[model samples]
Target: MRLARFRHDGRVRTGVVEGDHVLPFEGDPGMLEIIDGSAEQRTAGPVPLDDVKLMAPLQPRTLRDFVAFEEHVEGVRRSIDGSSGVPEAWYDAPTFYFTNPHRVYGPDDDIPFPARSVDRDFELEVAVIAGPEQSIFGYTILNDWSARDLQRREMQVSLGPAKGKDFASTLGPWIVTADELDPYHEEGFLDLWCTAQVNGVEVGRDLLSNMGWTFETLIAYAARDSRVMAGDVLGSGTVGNGGCLAELWGRNGKQDPPPLRDGDVVTLTVDGIGSLTNRVVTGPQTGDLPPVRRRDQAQARAERQH
Candidate 1:
């Protein structure tokens, strides 16, 4: 069953997407509840899908995005630090970072370019919605929006890329229950064919199986010293084969389709899960920040620029 959260008649509602329509749940149960088989009853007949506005699907309790793909780390590292070798530390385990869950977006939502970014990029990947215990509820296409300029500056400090990736992340169309993808399962991955298109031109394509770490391993690591709640989300990070512009630039040393501009539309389509699309828009402007606090750091910066 494909599950969706949408807005209809001025109220947010939950439903099961079947073909071209949606069967809204009685009392509009939360997505996690429906995933657990809590609400099996429907209020009325199927509503035409095109009529209502689909939401981000899951209101995650936590958003943990992992770098499960070696190729993603390899090329992105070169783009950021100009290094060709993969870090030895990355081989130890699945590494991830927490992002603000309150800032999530849905299909057809407009993503704002970060004020500091001259380049707009998107990471094509899959995400698993957590179910009861350690089980995965389902899958959804993920658009991990990136701001390369601010990301580089953050990486130089060895601490954060918070502002770089914090602005927006689009998820959904709907969630495809794990059982719906049973046929694509191989080894441990769904091995689905995924593609990205910018304004109707196909830019990248890759199989989900290219990632080195399995979802189960990543989930276990996430829950190792802690706990993952029912509505938590875990990302597969960027798949290989030009999933984002930075990776392509690192690999080819040239920008092909160039960075995203205001009004540009990005669509990520995956086998079994359908498409997740969004538009880009200019963000609000802000004032400047204060200079570096430490005199020694300021001197080092002058020397580096010199």
Candidate 2:
């Protein structure tokens, strides 16, 4: 079942998708209702998905996206050094970031390309939302659009990716229950056909089998010390073999990359799950607003406690 969250009458709601309609779910994290709730309990009010505004499927406390694709890793290395390689440490170290899961885009929602953004690119990936409040659940399509210029500038300060990735991170038409995807989940060879389209034009495609680390490994690594609660999302960093701009080819055009323009629609589709399309739009601002609310504040507080 495709589970989602939406806003109607100024309040956010949880629901499941059935064809063109959405069925509302009443619970804390819909995952609970999905796993244990009866068929009737799981079903609720229905509305046309196209008519109502969709929000991020889950209200995650935190998000961690990991680079699970080796081809993408090599592609990035070759772009940066011309050596076609990275240090051995990269293999051992799974790089990741704590992003604001609250800043999610829904189907048909408009994603604002920040004013500071110079090299805006789309990353077609799979996002995972944890279930059982402790166990890692599964994966879904994730489009981690990036502003390369801002990312590069901020990384030099060593406080990095904070300014770069904070604007927005897109996820879900809905969260697919783990059991629903079990048949496709394997050590190797999960036929994950994924692709990206910008303004209705195709740009990228890849398969899940290309990833360097499997979902299980990512979960084990992520669960080291931190408790991964229900609704926490994890992204399969840019897919193997040029999944996004940085990984694919770099600085080849006249400018860095085309900043997502107003009305530009970006669609990401994963074969089994479904498709998520978002329009590019400027967030509420006078000129170029200060970036959206800071997400790292919560991370900072978490770190202080430790």
Model 2 lDDT per residue over 14-67, tens place: 777788998776543444444433324455677887777877676566788887
Number of clashes in model 1? 0
Q: Candidate 2's error at 1, in angstroms?
A: 2.0
The candidate scoring highest on lDDT is: 1
lDDT over C-alpha atoms for residue 115 of model 1: 70
Per-residue lDDT of model 1, residues 1-306, tens digit only = 898999999989898898999999888788877866676666568999989999999888889899888888888888887899689999999889988788899989999887768878999989988888888888898888999888888878898778889888888989998889989989998889999999999888989998888888878889999998778899998988878878888887766568888989999999999999999998999789998676687889999998
Q: Name the top TM-score candidate.
A: 1
Judge candidate 1 at residue 179 and give its lDDT.
89
Q: Which ten residues in a row have the lowest lDDT in candidate 1?
A: 35-44
**Cα deviation in Å at residue 50, candidate 1?**
1.3
- Positional deviation of residue 180's Cα in model 2 after best superposition, in angstroms: 1.7
Give residue 66's lDDT in candidate 1 (0 to 100): 91
lDDT of each: 0.87, 0.70
